[model samples]
Target: MDNLLVKTGSSLKTFFTELGGISIMVFKAFAAIRIRHNFIPQIIEQFILIGKKSLPLVVVTSAFMGLAIGVQVGFQMTGFTPHWIAGGMILRTILIDLGPITIGLVLSGRISAGIAAELGTMKVTEQVDALRSFAIDPIGYLVTPRLIAAIFSVPALLVFSNSIAILLSYVSCNMTIHITWNEFVQGMRYSFYVSDLMTSLIKSLVFGVVLISLGAYFGLNCQRGAKGVGSATTLAVVWASVSVFVLDYVISTIVFYA
Candidate 1:
């Protein structure tokens, strides 16, 4: 029993220590931005990597999501409600809520996982050490760019995704339920507010930070060799996804009251 207790305590200690190290890395990523002119390229590169590259997936996924929601709402409103109202409500719920969250998840799979795998491989191959040898800060170069990308890209992706999703919703309604574009647009205007948009943007930012931080944390700490890189990559995605959920709840709580 004492041995088991000791092991448990040791595990908890390691967990917190890992968390602290990640926290410091995050702080450094933010701090590193103030040091130089390199930030502009980093920011631009990040915008492309995290946002531009993600557009196709975001658009395709969101469009389908919106379509599915429209269909489901139609079934739900079968007897009692007007087609236009149901279409509008679905569009509202999506733009105001699911749009950002879904985009964040898609990003976790594409952006976060890519960051982890790339960095983890670099670590195992001593590319990170190579950066250190040149007096280049590896964290500054690799980690900072990714952090910037994650921080900025999420909201952009959310906006892009949300817009596309709404477009799909409108079209679906028009085709199947005959909701006019004029009425659909009006419904969107009525149901969505600046506050809802703001709340979703906040959530996307939180998700972005969490995703990149976890990826960097795991990648930077990867053990020796190929297997270690793979393990780190896997852990990065898992932790990033879990962090997304936790942060989502925290943001929702704050938004609900704010």
Candidate 2:
């Protein structure tokens, strides 16, 4: 019992310590931002890296996600429930929850791991030290661009994902239940709201910040070794994915229930 209690307390302390470190990293990232020549170019490079590179995965995932939702909706339909209702269910599920959450989780694995590995490699090789030796702020040059790119790219990805998912879900609905495009769209129009769209965008934006910041924090603070770099990369992905779910629930509760 004593050992258990000691372990628990130590874990909590480590959690808070890391949390404080991440918070400080975030502050430093924003503080270091400046509209210099390198800044724009770096941001553009990140756009290609974060946005363009991520597109194919988003497309494939959203396509299958839409198909699954449509099939499930069809399976659950009864005589009492109109077939058209599938459209609203698919739209709401995609926009209000699944779309942003899927993108967040996917990017948490891809983007977060990539960021952590890159930075961790640099840290382990003393490249980060070299940057400091040159009087260059690593956070300014490396972290800030990624953060800014994520802010824009994540939402753009979400929009594309939502569109593809909804469209393919309609196709699936047609194949499953023989519903016309017009009927499906009518149901979507019936249930759609400006606020639902806003909720999705807001969630994507927050998810972007969480994934990038956590990745940067873990990478920059990694221990000194190849094994340490691997550990940081794994931790970054794990924590970013968990944070996405937690924040998703929080955002939904505040936006829809509160």
Candidate 3:
């Protein structure tokens, strides 16, 4: 019992310490954003890195997600409601919960790991310190662009993911339940609302901020070795993924209840 208590206390201390560090890093990154010569160019590069390169994975995952939801819902709704109801159910699930959550988790694994590994490598090799020696703000140069890119790219990705997921759901329903495109479209129109769309966009935006900021924080604070870099990379993915689910619940409760 004493040993367990000691481990629990140590874990709590580490958690809060890392949380404080991430908060400070987020604030600094936002403050570092400025209209400089390198800002736009670097942001453009990061947009390509974060947004474009991530498309294939997002597309594949979302398509399969939609198909799975469609099939499961279709099976459940059989003989209970009209085939069109399956379309409505699938849309609601994708838009309100599954779409953002799926994309967030996937990107948490891919983008967060990449950011942590890249920045951790730089930290371990003292490249970040080299920027300081040259009188350049590494946070401004390295972190700001990625932060901005994530903020913008995630919403864009969500939009694409939602659209693709809906389309694939429609296709899957057509194949499995003989629901026509018109029925699917009508069902979507019947159930869709502006508020739900807004909530999804807001959730995606928050998730983007959380994942990228945590990744950068872990990477920048990594210890002095390859093993430290590896640990940071692993923690970056794990914590970012965990944060997504926690934020989803918090945001959903607030949005739905308040």
RMSD of each: 2.4, 0.9, 1.0
Where does candidate 2 stray beyond 4 Å?
A: none
Q: What lDDT does the true structure give each of the candidates?
A: 0.79, 0.92, 0.89
The residue-by-residue lDDT of candidate 3 on 1-258, one tens digit each, is: 999999999999999998998888889999998888858998999999989999999999999998888777767766758877777788888888999999899999988999999999999999999999999887878888999999999999999999999888877777788888888888888888888898899999999888888788888888989999999999999999999899989988998899
Regarding TM-score, does 1 or 3 come out ahead? Answer: 3
lDDT of 2 by residue, 1-258 (tens): 999999999999999999999989989998987889858988999888889999999999999999988888877775778877888888999999999999999999989999999999999999999999999999988899999999999999999999999998888888888889888998899999999999999999999988999988899989989999999999999999999999999999999889
- How many backbone overlaps does candidate 3 show? 0
**Using TM-score as the measure, what is the rank order of every candidate, best first?**
2, 3, 1
Model 3 vs. true fold: TM: 0.97
TM-score of each: 0.89, 0.98, 0.97
User: What is the clash count of model 2?
Assistant: 0
Mark the 10 consecutive residues where model 1 has the least summed lDDT. 79-88
Q: Which pairs clash inside model 3?
A: none
Candidate with top lDDT is 2
Model 1 per-residue lDDT tens digits across residues 158-256: 888877777777777666667677776676666766777788888888888888888787888889888888888888878777777777777778877
Report the C-alpha displacement of residue 77, candidate 2, in angstroms: 1.8
